[model samples]
Target: MIKVVSKIMINSSAKQVWNVISEIQRDPYFWKGMSRVRTTSKNGNALTRQVTLANSEKCLQKVILFPIEGIHIRWTRGMITGTKDIMITQIGTQTLLEVEMNYELHGIAQVRSRSISEELRDEAELAVHLVKEEIEKTQAFPTESRKQWADMIHE
Candidate 1:
């Protein structure tokens, strides 16, 4: 199994960050190398999407863990046994977003996965960077009223 962790600190409230990322359907617009994600099926909190990569390859990605309303989102790709966990935390006036990704590559996929591991890591960093840049540029929550941290997380 291969694991990668990426983090970024955004100059926005956690609530604001969660509001933007909770909508997994919009990931293609922000995440590098991801061209599109189309929902294929949904059952309660579980979701499956047909994901098209920037390279024109496509695969099925399943939502093993959905966004907990205002907390985090997690998904897995069966093709590569890949899993990703996106978590957000509030730190004073800023928000910390972290993504933990793990993938088990078998047979030929192992070579491909290893060869592109750096690129994969870079993509993760780039995604969060884009999020931070966009959020800071828009100041989407400039006027967000201060709420108890717990309240925001559970809201």
Candidate 2:
């Protein structure tokens, strides 16, 4: 198993940060190298999406475990399996958002020349920065977003 973790502080509230990161539909905008995301299926908290990478490779990812009020989501498909955890702490009006991705390479894909762990680490860090920028740029946290935050809080 391989793990890569990245942490960042965003100038927003925990509820504000949660609203952005929890919505998978807007993922491509925040994560570089991700071209698109198409929702394939949804069952309760589980959502399956087809993700297109920048290299044009497509992968099906099943978000199997996601609690409405929780900070983590577990997903897996093919040789990749992982959990993305978003830890939020409010400092006045700002939020300290820590996103951690823990993934493992399986099967033949595990036999790679370059370090897959290193690549994942870089990607994870980039994801954190991108998320921060997206939130700051949009200045999100509208009524609907606040509703989602409220739902998550209630859960």
Models, CA RMSD each: 10.5, 11.5
Kindly state the number of residue pairs that clash in model 2. Answer: 0
Question: Model 2, range 84-111, lDDT digits (tens) per residue?
Answer: 7767777797877776777776665589
- Model 1: per-residue Cα lDDT over 1-155, one tens digit each: 77889998988888788878877788887778788889988887677788887876676777744443232333354345667788888899998998888877655557787666777788888889988887888874447668898898987
Q: Give the 10-residue window scoring lowest on summed lDDT in candidate 1.
A: 66-75
Q: List candidate 2 segments past 4 Å from native.
A: 64-71, 140-155
lDDT of 2: 0.71
lDDT of 1 at 22: 75
Worst 10 residues of 2 by lDDT: 64-73
Give candidate 1 regions above 4 Å deviation: 64-78, 106-108, 140-155
lDDT at position 32, candidate 2: 65
| CA error at residue 151 for candidate 1, angstroms | 46
